[model samples]
Target: MSLSGKLETDVELKASAQQFHEVLCSRPHHISNVSPSKIQGVQLHQGEWGKEGSVIICNYIHDGKAKVSKEQVEKIDPVNNSVTYKVIEGDLLNEYKSFKITVQVTPKGTGSVSHWTYEYEKLHPGISHPETLLQFAAELSKEIDSHLTSAK
Candidate 1:
């Protein structure tokens, strides 16, 4: 099946969209509560954070085994409150030809809508669409919202 998914969440727009974008794109590792049990750590590999061409390595557990994946920032648009990252190498390489994930924020009344999109091409028709990935994005959004709510 052609793989694609989009998840959206509404959150306080108090912090500039750029700020949230920076946290998601660069400082994801800074977020402790939102990280999944599978994820052990994340590290910046090359280039500056929140910039195009920057790379990050994510260490994770898959099937009860540790695995590492490399991803590179493909685009950043502060004005649009969007950032896109492309998978460069990792275990995902075995299943998908390519993967690009985009996070976008747009104002909605007093809050903002965070849109997470995943675009990918499965190596085989048997590969299922990433519903869990969308759930992960939703959980992250909830964590961010809760953090902000508690800080206020």
Candidate 2:
């Protein structure tokens, strides 16, 4: 099997695309408040939030295990409502040689859809595809949508 691969999942949200994208790009640290069970905390380690090259350390839970991922904001395209982050350190690096995540929110009628992409290369072929992590992200998206809709 190939050691490098990409996985994607789309989550439907009641919030507008702009609102969802703004939360991720401008205020990701607030995600911990909306999805405390999944994301415990997010701290800016360098630069500023939402800007490319900024680094953030995220404390989260995956598959019932607490994990930390320090990632650098790689790109942010406001026109497309997309943000990409490259994992530079922490738990996931233990299994994967490299990992990148991109989130794009697009308007769909009255609601929106969040498209999540996970691109990674494994340290060895023994490592399984990150299906569980994708599910975690999708669930986190739903939680954020719930919070955004309720707040308005």
**Largest lDDT belongs to which candidate?**
2
Return the clash pairs for model 2, or none: none
Q: Residue 150, candidate 1: how far off, in angstroms?
A: 1.9
Q: Which stretches of candidate 1 lie over 4 Å from their true place?
A: 1-16, 33-39, 60-67
Residues 64-115, candidate 1: write the lDDT tens digits: 6777779998998888888888999998778878888888987666567778
- Runs off by more than 4 Å, candidate 2: none
Which tens-of-lDDT digit does each residue in 13-94 have in candidate 2?
9999999999999899999989999999999999998899999999999999999999999999999999999999999999
Residue 130's C-alpha lDDT in candidate 2?
98
Output the worst ten-in-a-row residue range by lDDT, candidate 1: 1-10
- Each model's lDDT comes to 0.73, 0.96
Separate clash counts for every candidate: 0, 0
Q: Residue 91 of candidate 1: its Cα lDDT?
A: 82
Cα displacement (angstroms), candidate 2, residue 144, comes to 0.2
TM-score of each: 0.80, 0.98
**How many backbone collisions does model 1 have?**
0
